[model samples]
Target: MFTTNPFDDDKLREECGIFGVSRAETASAIVALGLHALQHRGQEAAGITSWDGHDFHTHRAMGHVAGNFDRDEVIRGLPGDTACGHVRYSTTGETSLRNVQPLYAELNSGGFAIAHNGNISNAMKLRRELIRRGSIFQSTSDTEVIIHLVATSSYRTLLDKFIDALKQIEGAYSLIVMTPEGMIACRDPLGIRPLVMGKLGDATIFASETVAFDVVGADYVRTVEPGELVIVTNEGDIRSHRPFGETHARPCIFEHVYFSRPDSIIDNSSVYSVRKAIGAQLAIENPVDADYVIPVPDSGVPAAIGYAQQSGIPFELGIIRSHYIGRTFIQPGDKVRHLGVKLKHNANRALIEGKRIVLIDDSIVRGTTSLKIVQMMRESGAAEVHMRIASPPTKHSCFYGVDTPERTKLLAHKLDIGGMQDFIHADSLAFISIDGLYKALGETKRADIRPQYCDACFTGDYPTTLTDQDDVVVQNQLELLAERVV
Candidate 1:
């Protein structure tokens, strides 16, 4: 079931986004444009694989799609009616060239290309079993593990092999595969990641978000049902199949809260409108007497507007984001990553000087970014910074797809509200109540089909238990870190 809590504060992390096209013309260019719309989900790497029913051509690079496939020669190089693309953000494996997806494998039957959005919780077990059968791995990613399993399967047909492979694996996965025959898209039985279909005249496209379909002037059809597989052929035939019976349809609610664009819709709900309602609910639940309601730029913009409208407080863009700030410069180093947020955002001193500020932010994952923002606001002469989070406190880690680690890595799990106020240097800290959050999104009923959210990170309600010793080791490491901090 989906976990809905207002006080559950956690920074929502995005996994990845996918786009695939099946048309006779320049499918590579169409995929490039579709990937551009879905780029908000990932930034680490971009890749596209095209097949012309005869041969497969692939292009991959470690940057935004614009720079990675910037040249016409690169796009023109891959000619095929059917193409699959991926924009990746590493939540599990090390961020490197080898990890860039659209992981392709060649077998005696033919070559198949695959791009996946979510993670498998039991990947270690699956990889171990495959290795026992003598399968060599080029990348440390769990996604590659799936391809290997399917390739070595006894099933003669690719679709049968795919079904057989999924039966052995457990956890969240929204996959798109390219075969010699056609294009295949499948979502996990739980549907933790978002995948939707669209139609533009005579063409059919599948993407991680509805925004991608909108870019190509395609009309939204519907979300790929949980435990369902969709196939699109070269002749423009679309087929849907549900092999798995009634399982939990636990779509990631965080997608509506943070990962997806406000303009996009997921699971038949408008993400932007739902987020605005969350802010409105926050204002009503925790009304603050402040001069102005300021948002933490970008992510907080929509919610801030709703909060201001609900509380009768003036809305102001107190923080401005600089688009020119390249995402690549924020390396893994502590000092470098810490300064990245500062370079990306700056406080509007002229508007905030000596004002009582009610700062709205989506979530505080590590608290580093929020701490920096609050300190910057104080330096800009803000009298007091009251932090209001739009979602609940994240107390656990998400193993499904998101990069959230063990409970020890979560600030809310380690510190109380008061301690968090001190750590962030905010005069006050109040998060939206979980009930109120669900009410705003109209997901108050626990038994509703689409109401169950993947609150594993916020509530520790992990859907699947980890059995691998290595997973336990990672969890223990986080526990040790938390103990030392306490």
Candidate 2:
């Protein structure tokens, strides 16, 4: 039996989702709803920690939010006026209940609960140093390193220590921390990860996406600015601080392409609109003669519409995806596994047969899915298959929050456009240029000096130092050498 999760391997996995609320009557319940809205970001584990003034209550489970937090008893177990929750897909830690977020630690000051949304690039180095200093760790998660840093900080106040811990960390983060004093929310200095603040009457809300606020009847306030911290007290007093000083914002461009929901807005731009713009740009760059423009389904829908509109090609649902299936299905044997893409998606044979089709998609990662998808279309008798990608080729692996395979595994990193076209068995393949991608974002072109967004996966201009990955490479090499010697 094939027990592996097939649906997740082809796409760039999202980092995590975080939701928190202060001064709500049923804060844990509200958090559960909010996490449900942001569930696409993660599916491995879910956790919530709430403060009932006198004590902190926590419940964490190694599964989806609906399975773990949908029950009344689960929500009732976490009674408090303030609560924070996390839905995690691990990038820097093993997938285990112990690695789940809303990671609570009782400090000398009081109980501290934290939920994180991004990767700490220097976490391994920090973990090694902290371990050498005799700091006992409860979890192998990189998010735990932040708590250790806060615990060892020389700062007097809890807030100061939290900020002190953040200052020492590198890479992306959108953190929601609940304390005995209040609830705190902050984003990284570069704004690489997204966090938004909102309000529901007297309740103050913080979530990874605006869609979460929409789910709980909360009005969107504003995005938590890069390097800015906002604290909401038990009495509903709000305070904002800028601790990281000034820095250029480089929000992840991939969020618009795949991670964020189409309904959500980030930095005053509609994600749906941005994706449409990307598709329009792709159409302008790579026009092709086709009978119909078809999306890969779901993620590619918006872009496919845009491409069709721009190219004067009729858009049709040439492929249908099954919604009832979970992310994975246990294949009974090789025969079932060979069914491949048909398990999740099937070509509308009547619509696709004898038609020259233009297929639109957000991004192609490892290319395994693309290969299978193309084969599916061919098997269904597509006369011609022209593949158009809305974003530039993803050549480098992401070291920030987004979970991507290594360079060796990336299709773009190993193959040029011609090579990819042959590999996927498509009649033609074209990806939007990097400059065209910036144009879709309303820029004339990408800035050569400092990019307006983190397109590192496309451009290889990483914004932060990748210290952990460097150490990992060295360790792997040493292990290989030792094996050879033995």
Candidate 3:
């Protein structure tokens, strides 16, 4: 299927979004509303699981949440007072109905359902061991590993078994789990992924972003602290545990750059404010003169405004984006298919004609989108199109729940700034420095101390070891060595 946003093809995709609420009326409806607020996080599939005290009911669909969960019949079918839902883009698992979550299973303790929003770096290593030990598998999703681990743990209680499962995994995650006993929401030790707690009347809510809470008219309480597991029981008792102990937190830096909605709040900072700060930082670091400071469109708006303010350049709508387009269209021919890009974004030729405009974008991944956008600007009679990226160059693949291209496929990995400028055919191009990015986040330069955020895509300073990826590398080398010997 084709993407609705043509310019989004080269962007890094956030793997998933999760939401859960307990002690709420029509819990599945609340989950659906929350998931709609988080649609940007993932769009490939959506699911909601609700426990109606006696049994768990779920509806999983392979598309946007609107078409699947917006129907009354669908929400009514999931009868319960507590529910959790997920939107998935398949960073690790295959894209199929089987891989959609909240994945449910009947354990010895009772019914259990889980919705996950992150990647498990050691999943493949653990999966092999679980299979070797006779655990029957289901989906290929790394999240299923958590279920198997919990099922096989020798602990007496379900809570202990869940904690035991957490200890065996690595990498980033923020999960919402539902069982007969309670609803559990927790983050990985480093808190590489974000999860926030909110309140709606008597109900307790948990979501990947505060925006979800806002959508359902819930008040944001605070972030679920790093390494903390918060449980809201069937009896309405709320408890917290710091099972992983204290550890330095390293949340994904790109959330501020791209993943989150501008209206969301993360770590007490407004996402919109942070993005604007990033643009201001970009302007301070790379001053440019142009007729108009134009944003690439919605995502780039805040940054463009910040840049325009900082540089004293007038911001203009050089490109207009259409929000009404569907996810895909049947491509009958090459010419028609190429026009799909214009259906999403078209040049405002009247404003852009004979103007030297600076296009501000969040980030450049493979540079394919940037190239198309720049070419569009030129075709609109723009005298010169300068490009300013809000974030630092992405040079490494993300293993923490983001769908990223391989290292070699990343344009930043393959090319220097000058090369990228030429490749995108921009009159000039500049990206925020790594130091500038930290400064925007209200921190000192990266060189001055250990990094506070997971900027591994730019700096390659991974917060956790990637066992599965390393195993693949080692296997590839072993095969190469055998080939040489033969």
Candidate 4:
């Protein structure tokens, strides 16, 4: 007997998703729908917290949103006019319900609830300092550090305290906070993570993606600007502030590449169109002679279409995916594991056999999946398998919010282009140039002085300070010195 595991992939994972609404009669229910739409961002756990004027209510569970928030009883129990929700895939904390978001606390001001999407790069250092100052933490999540910071701030107003807390933190964050006073939403200074504002009737909405707004039947408003904060009062008065001051905004480029849904818009560009552009650019940069262009399915479909159109080659669905399998499943044994790509994907033998094919994929991380996929093509009687990747090689790990392997483990870091081609057993392999990637984004080329987006995984040009990682390096050096002394 064989079983499939969907988590066996070579791609990066997003940190989390956040959705919030203010002054709505069915706030919790609306938030549930929004979170459901954004579920692809996180699948480990889901939570929602709402304020019903006088009291706060919460419901959290470990699993998909449909398993927990889909029940009518669950929604009815959480009665509130203002609500915020989170779906989490842990990046900086353990996989436990205690680390789930929509974390709540009662301060001198009133009840407070918050949901966050992004990693705090300096959380470990901040956690150490806060513990030294007698702060007690309820969860191991980095988001909890923000709660403690707000609780101890001397600022009289809740908004000021929240701003004060944000000032002390570093790295990416898009926060949706709910208090008895109202709902507050803000994006980090560099906009490393995404947050958008929308409107449903008189109700104000905030979510990690525009797709969530569509799910709730809300009118799409603009993205919450970098370093900008908006507070929706209990009485429904909206106020905007720029507490963090202006800086060069370098939003994560991966959102367009993989993180966001095709329908959603980020930084005023359509994600679907941007992906197609990337494929077109890839075709121009790495033109290949093949009988047909075949997408890997799902994520690769749009790019493959663009590649075919640009290269004047026929596009075909040469691979099919099984949607029935869940994100993860327990493998029965090694026999099943060796089945490899067949568990989730199967080659269209009639279409692939005796054909020279150009296989298009969004990106390659470890090359394990690519190797298996190429081997499957050969088994299906394909004459030649040319792998065409839409993005530049991923040589560095992401430190902001994406879950990526270390540099030593990255396939690109370990192998050059020729080595990768041999490792994957592909007839030939090519990736989009870094400058070509920028061209797809409407720029002539990437600016060496100040690149428009954060391509840290591709270019290794991190936009923010990496304080915690530096501290770790220093600590490891001291430990090694002590061992030598002994």
User: lDDT per residue, candidate 3, 61-154, as tens digits?
Assistant: 8889988988889989999999999999889888889999999888888888999999999999999999999998889899999999999999
Which portions of model 4 miss their true places by more than 4 Å? 1-7
Tens digit of per-residue lDDT, candidate 4, span 263-331? 999878899999999999999999999999999877888789889999999999999998766665765
| lDDT per model vs. reference | 0.83, 0.92, 0.92, 0.91
Residue-level lDDT of model 1, residues 247-327, one tens digit each, is 777787678678898899977888888989999999998898899999987899888888999999999989988877555
TM-scores, in order shown? 0.92, 0.97, 0.98, 0.97
* Local error of candidate 4 at residue 66 (angstroms): 0.7
On the 0 to 100 scale, the lDDT of residue 197 in model 1 is 85
Clashing pairs in 3: none
For candidate 2, lDDT tens digit of each residue in 1-486?
A: 213366658899988999999999999999999999999999878899999999999999877788789899999999998999999888888888899999999998999999999999999999999999999999988899999999999999999999899989999999999999999999999999999999999999999999999999999999999999999988899999999899899999999888999999988999999899899989999999999999998899999998999999999999999876765466446767767677688999999999999999888999988988999999999999999998889999998878889889999999999999999999999999999988988999999999999999998999988889889889999999999999
Which window of ten consecutive residues has the lowest lDDT sum in model 3? 1-10
Tell me the spans in candidate 2 whose CA falls farther than 4 Å from its real position.
1-4, 474-486
Residue-pair clashes per prediction, in order, are: 14, 0, 0, 0
Candidate achieving higher TM-score, 2 or 3: 3
The TM-score that candidate 4 achieves is 0.97
